[model samples]
Target: MIQVLEVKTEKDIKEFIDFPFKIYKGDKNWVPPLKNDEKKMFSPHTNPELEFCDTQFWLAKDNGKTVGRIITMINHKYNEKVNKAYARFFKFESINVEGGEQLLLFAENWAREKRSTHIHGPLGFSNLDNQGLLIEGFEYLPSIASTYNKVFYKDIFDKLEYQKENDWIEFILYPEDCIDERILKLNETIKKRYNLIVNSFKKRKELQPFIPQVLEVLNQAFAELPYVIPFDEKTGSYYIEKYFSLLNPNLIKIITNKDGEAVAFIVGLPSLSRAMQKANGKLSPWGIYNIFRAINHPKVVDLALTAVLPQLQRQGVAAVLITELQKELIRYGVKEVETTGIFETNTQAVQTWKNFKHIQHKRRRCYVKEL
Candidate 1:
């Protein structure tokens, strides 16, 4: 018999976090998240989102062996903003269809008890968290910001009668193919026409003051996107502290208008997928060495985020930002550029990517089911 148990004890929490390590074993493309990071995410003291969200973790077991894990959440803030009673499921992993079904059923029942009318996810407390299920490109290694899973995991969602709520697509770009003489010239013209200035940083401290303004632009830029919530002051600070140390200053670019206010920004990181895999979810001496090595001599870069102020959309600000970042990537001798998820319906963003030699190789999905 299969059994689903709430993760209430310390041991249960460890099992919940460790379950994926077992499921993805021997899968060359899977990247393990840092174990310390996983622990912090579940703690209320560390993850500010826990202060406002109702959350629970669960483990599915058969014959006393762990088979699966899942998390159920209700973001009261999100529900109030969208004016809908919706719950979310995230960090879902399972060894087989049966284990997946049991864990999902438990989550559904719990959501109903909480008075939610519909449930959707592979989403998390906020957009900053990893969201979506891998629906395609299983053979390719996922970026540190993307999601990955066994192909069979989709079958469980199908059997549960869940339908697609949204889809996010990812791409791999060749910087050589993306560099265009016309765009470079256009960037110069656009900068002169709009009186926009591009800012590049060589040190983390130099980028600190602009952080708040960049996040404000990010809030305004993504306000209309699905599953978005604005970053409150505390939340923004938390993220800054969490990720600021990992960023390479050379990979960040910002654009300011004549008034010197940040209106657009692009953030990239040296691809740490291989390094994280080498770490095997631990920060051992060797793991720390591998991470620093990748940071210092990166060949692959992940374009993690780009945001343009709402009023500035279609004004070529984005193009200018990309051109500046492209120059830096070339200087770094970068070979491959991986993008985080872009919603499939975002035609403008999709078209922007097609300008380069690229492959829309990966797709992730958020599934929904009415309770």
Candidate 2:
């Protein structure tokens, strides 16, 4: 018989965090997440999101061996905004099909007890967290910002009768497929017309001052997006500290208006996928060195995010941001870039990448079912 138990003790939490290692042991495409980072997300003192969200983690054991793990989370802010009680699952992993079913049923029952009317995810505490299940692109390795799982995981979700809530698509770009000349000329024209300036920094310290403004712009730009809940001040600060600190200054480009307020921005990280694989998700001396090597001499870059103010959308600001960032990426000898995830319905964002020779290599889906 399969036994499901809630994560209670520190030992249980550690097992929950480490379950993926066993599940993806020989999978080259699976990038291991840092254990400490995973732990921090579950700790209320570290992750402010816990204050507003209710969460439970579970481990499935058979014959005293952990065969699966899952987390059920309720983002109250998201529910309040969408006016639907939703309980989301994240970090779902299972070795056996039957075990996966039991995990979902356990979460569904828990959500029902909490008065949640529906269950969804493969999602997490916030948008910045990795969300969605990879339904395609099993060959390509996932970037650190994305998730990868066994192909069979989709089959399990299918059996549970979870309908698609939404899908996010990913694209891959090569250096040979740079922006077209006409777009470059258009970007110049837009910059001159709108008094837009693309800002570059020489050092991480130099970029520090603009971090808050860039985040503020991101929150505003992404506010109208479907299923988005704007980040609170504390949550915003938490993410800024967590993510931005690791970015290479040269990979970030911020667009400002004549008044010097940031109107648009794009951020990329030297692809650390291989480095993470090498580090095995540890950040000790060798792991830290691997990351620094990837930063200074990266073979691939991962486009993390791009955002523009609603009023400035389609005013050529998007094209300008990409064009300017493209030059820097080339200078750094970067060959290819993987766009982490773009919502399927984000036509404007999707259209911007169409100008380049690219492949829609990966697709991830959010699954939903009535509780």
Candidate 3:
């Protein structure tokens, strides 16, 4: 028998977070998230996103042993904007198809009680959080920002009649192939024509002040993307604290126009998947050293996020950012680059990868079912 328990106490939440550790114990590709970091998302004080969303966590127990976990979330902004009571389920994990089914049913009932008409995800509060379940490239170690999961996991969603809502594709690139002389020249021309400037900093302090504007540009740039809830000041600050602070200054590229308004930006990090794997999700002295080592000497870097303002799309502004990125890659002696997922429907973003020698190695999807 499957017993679904609501996660109410701190101990129960800890058990919810630790369940994956049990399932992926012998799996080599699995990367455990830092415990403290995982806790912050469940805390309203730490994650400002909770202010605009309602969420519930549940764990499945079989014979009194925890077997699965899931989070049911309803973003008020998304529901209001779409004019539909759509709920999302993410942070999903299970040991078997039955366990997975029980977890999904728990989420569906919760959403139904809230008057939601549809349920979708393997999505989180926003795009910044991990979304999608890994449907391919099981052999490849996932980057810090991406997800990794057992291939059989999809069977549960299929059995539950969840139709594919969207798919995001990931690519692997040879940084050296990203540099094309013609594009470099084109970038120079675009910069001159548009009075655009590419800013590079050797220190994090220099990049701090521009964080707000960078996020504002991000909202403008990705406003049209599916399920993208624009970030307000509080949410923006929370993101900078969580993800941006860990970025190496040299790997960031920010492009601005004559008035110093950001038009494009790209953020990459030396891949720390391996380091985190070795640390088993703890970031103490040795783990911290491994992370620093990865930053200073990474063979594979992860292109985590990139965006260009809608008005500036297809204006060669992206080429300007890439040209600068190529220089940084070469300087770092990086061999390969793994890109974070880009929505398959986002043709503009997907097209940019075609310019380089790359392959779509991994694909993930969001599944949905009408209530």
Candidate 4:
């Protein structure tokens, strides 16, 4: 017999967070998340989104043995904007096909109650977190910042009648590889014409002067994106200070305009999968050591974010950004890069990597249904 239990208390919530650690226990490709960090999202006190969304987390069990988990979420903000009923299943899991279908059925009906037309997910409550499933790259080790799933996982979705709605790509670049001479010449020309420079932060202190400006640019650049709610000063500053502090300064390049404004740029952070896996997402004395060590010892650089102001778009700003970062990767002995999820509909961002020969190695989809 199987049963689905909704997350209602601390104990239930912990199971949802730690279940993955046990599921992929010996799998070398698995990267465990930070427990405290994971907990914050589900905690009513910590997850600010609860103010605007509703979520019901589920755990699947067979004869009282926990087997899988999923979250059925309705972002009111999403429904109100698109005028539809939709739900997302984040951290979906299952040991049996039957059990998994039950979880989906529950969420499907939840959407149906709102008179939804179709249901889609494996998405987070919002875009800031992981939002896709892995339809490819099972043969490679999943990075700290990317998603990984068993081939069977996709099969489960198919059996449940879930269809692919979008996909994105991750690429690898080597320092030894030379940028095409023509492109290099063009970048050189653009640089001289704009009086621009492509470079990374050499010290934390150096970024203090411009980090605020970078935040301003980010807000402006991303203002028109859907489902995006601009972060306030405190939250935005927290992200820059907390995240930028851990990044490999070498892998982050700030592209400036002739007037000294950072018009286009790329920011990459060191992957901490190994450390998080070791800590089980704890940060006690020893856990802190693993995290600190991961800073300088990151095996993969998470290409966290890239942005170009619309005024500078299609002007080779993207290419210049990548070229400078590639040089930095070579200097720091880095091997791989994982980018943030790109909208599947955003073809311009997809085709921007003309030099990389990207393999479309990852796929994440978002589904829509009418309310």
What lDDT tens digits, residue by residue, belong to model 2 across residues 112-192?
998999999999888888889999999999998988988888999899899998999999987554557887888889999
| Steric clashes per prediction | 0, 0, 0, 4
Model 4: weakest 10-residue lDDT segment is 362-371
- Report the number of the highest-lDDT candidate: 1
Report the lDDT of model 2 for residue 318.
Answer: 83
Worst 10 residues of 3 by lDDT: 174-183
- Tens-place lDDT digits, model 1, residues 1-371: 99988888889988988888887888899999988889877888888899888998888989999999888999988888899999999999989888989988888999999999999999998998889999999989999999998798899899999999999999998878347778788889988988899999999999989988998999999999999998988888888886787788999999998999999999988999999999999999999899888877888999899999988888888877777888888898897999999999998776655556788999999999999
Quality of model 4 by C-alpha lDDT: 0.71
Encode model 3's per-residue lDDT on 70-140: one tens digit a residue.
Answer: 99999999888878889999899999889999999989999999999999999999998889988889998
Worst 10 residues of 1 by lDDT: 348-357
Pairs clashing within candidate 1: none
RMSD of 1: 1.3
What is the C-alpha lDDT profile of model 4 across 199-280, one tens digit per residue? 5677767777667667766766776665555555554553554456566676678887667878777887777777777776
Q: Rate the local accuracy (lDDT) of all candidates.
A: 0.89, 0.87, 0.86, 0.71
* Model 4 lDDT at residue 285: 86
RMSD values, in order shown: 1.3, 1.4, 1.3, 3.1
